[model samples]
Target: MSVGKLPVIDLTPMRAGDEFHKRALGDALREACVHTGFFYVAGHGVPQALIDRVFAASKAFFDQPMADKRKVDKALSAANRGYEFLGGQTLEPGAPPDLKEGFYIGEELAEDDPRVLAGAFNMGPNQWPAGVPDFAPVMMEYYGALLELSREIMAALALSLELPEDYFEAFCTEPLATLRLLHYPPQPAQPLPGEKGCGAHTDFGGVTILLLDDKPGLQVWDALNERWLDAQPIPGTFVVNLGDMIARWTNDRYRSTLHRVINTSGAERYSVPFFYSGAPQHEVRCLPGCLGEGEQPKYAPVTVEGHLREMYRRTYV
Candidate 1:
């Protein structure tokens, strides 16, 4: 059971009717947000049964023959909106490609939305497998719920940072999102040069909310220890971590750590991680309080479109 050191915080019922409950959760978030930049979110309203259903669907989808899954492969489309099978690189330099196969889907958008058409990665329509019944709709329902939950957490983060509760709300409406259904098959009989379940790369979105199975490959870098620390799954909790965009918004106050997935034990693993980001057209800049009065801006303002493009350039090329 010993994987590695990790952090967890229980946020049960932050929207409780009692005022004390709200303050306590907010205070806890403030402390953890500043120190860890990642924590477990419990008491999030999503049902356990719903999660189990999604996990089941995910496993069934990946269980199909590789050739069948590739029929909907994301590589087949310029939209980047379908399956990215096993052995895809993380787009980081020198690091190895991930050993997992994934099904990536984002919000279905109309071309008229200037932001969706212009922004990369997220805004396109998802490719559904005609063979799988109700697959797309159920996944969409799950995504919708997580998006709502992310918004609530963002409000709390804003309050923790001593900013307006809605400071991030407007900019995040219909944000760019990704619901990645991942499956890491057992380690190959012979390993590649640098292959692992996934390479070390900080998430590019505002925050990553992950629902992981009890597989032991997921590791988050411990800044203080400077080592790859295991992140064991706790049932009833979603592991939430700050990503590069949130780091920028906070003026680097919070961290964006290097995390990787490695499975030396030869176990097949599955995880569903939701990458929640700002609205496609929103511009991200350091908040006033984070910058302080008359203090120099730590980061230049950049639109979501520009920031993501630069990230893709750095990682994809």
Candidate 2:
């Protein structure tokens, strides 16, 4: 079956017991990954109510006055959690700061946890805003749901690569995951030439699952056509995309396409993107069968922690 610029995949067959259906779904996923590295997922089984609650919580938190939101400034957290005001992040060096404010959350770890005790980067407790009483609970619930969904999707991706469905299981224990809530305020009618809600860049982790409101701001770079294509929002679906780590693992067979947000709709936009990665100590080497005869691996093996730390340093100003 021919797919459009972006395909919408139903994940129901992945949960079915029949091997035939599962393989078919895997084949579809492989096609999408090789071609675009981006797709919309439906029938993912995440409760709509949970999604709504998370969005409501995000709105409530971002709606607070600037002074109130600044109390949990991300600059104060060693783990990069908490609120990041506008101009705090610059995805592309030398570019203007992204015109968005965000709140970052990660798995909560106690001060004495082994990872925390070892001073592992990005493995620590998150800073929650005092103003939004329900934000922490709602976001934590949503994060757990997305993490489960990511596991299922990872299994499908493994099958697509002709690997065992559980091939990634070992690497996922104590994974490094983050849920980012972003708010882009309305832009002027005629803005500066280079101003954008977000600069063009690819994600640094294994995969990103994004929940977007009804808006037309996201755009994906069409490398083949040398044009930008709108990744318009579709109700009840999450926009799933491959990240740099996955592309490296696949030996460049799969793309980690560049994407950016520009809120030209003149309205506020909110999105939640969950980034999932393997355990920090796991080294990402080119996968078996990803290379053919005489094909060379394009990247050297790197530990998840090292790569992520470098990326965070470059992007988070």
Candidate 3:
């Protein structure tokens, strides 16, 4: 695999239940995790129809006039959700806004819950656009379905860690999840100095499951080689990557390489990502197998909520 290029791994047999097939799946995952935090997961049982419906709805949503979409602006939630207009985002420092617009969604939890405290990880409620008639329903349905699929994937992760497949269950119940929809218009023939669809940055949560349209211009950084590499979307496949917490939990056995999106295409590009995170207040520590032997604990334990608050405060505010 080229440097900065996300490896494409076929995940079919990994989901298989036969005891005879377990080792193969484990090996595949182990290689992927340790080498490249990014991979194309094909053969995971998510329905094509659901994925299609999501992208289709995304197109419709982005096509609406900016004013119409802004009717339910995230200004209320302080831009935690709702819409982000083109040239309105940047995760990289000293860079212009990303050449894209998007909607960020997450699980709806009670504001009074401890998880919703000012310093809590899941404090924000969703900011929705009332203009789109079925927006809420469609999003909710898609989220529920993806949530199940994510849990199944997490089970495989548990197995890979040599623990009971239920290792990630604690994070799933009342999961702190996010669904982000992105639209990137084509870059102008003569582009601005530092604009990109998305700046190079690593995710701050657990794992991110992304559904990208069949477009060119997305790239994942290869830690091995310092360069930008393309991430082309394949039909019927989803891209998965580890975030900060998962990388920390594994004692850096897994790599969380920095990735970015560039609108190199002559035409617009669109992508939707469902970010699965955990209760911010939960403490994250290296699992026993990850750092028990040769690997000494590289990082001390930190509460998820506190870590999240610090990250968000830096990024958002």
Cα miss at 33, model 1 (Å)?
Answer: 2.3
lDDT of 2 by residue, 1-317 (tens): 11235998888877864888889888999999998899999999999999889889999998999999989998888888999998777776667888999999999998899989999988788998888778888999898899889998999999899899999997788799999999998766776666789989999999999999997788888888877889889999999999989998899999999988888788899999999987998999999999999999988999999888877777663
RMSD of 3: 2.5
lDDT of each structure?
A: 0.78, 0.89, 0.77
TM-score of model 2 relative to the true fold? 0.96
My TM-score estimates for the predictions, one after another, are 0.91, 0.96, 0.90
Q: How do the residues 1-317 of candidate 3 rate in per-residue lDDT, one tens digit apiece?
A: 23344556555655555655665566677788888788877777778877777777788889999788887566657427788777777888898878888888877655665656764454567776766667777787888877987887777677677777777778777767889999998877777677777888999888888888878777887656666677777788888988888898888888777888877668879888888876655678988688755658888888776666677898889
Ranking of models by TM-score: 2, 1, 3
Error of 2 at 273 (Å): 0.4
lDDT of 1 by residue, 106-130 (tens): 8876656675567555566678776
Q: Which ten residues in a row have the lowest lDDT in candidate 3?
A: 1-10
lDDT of model number 2? 0.89
lDDT for position 227 in model 3:
62
Regions of candidate 2 where Cα sits further than 4 Å from its true position:
1-4, 313-317
What clash count does candidate 2 reach?
0
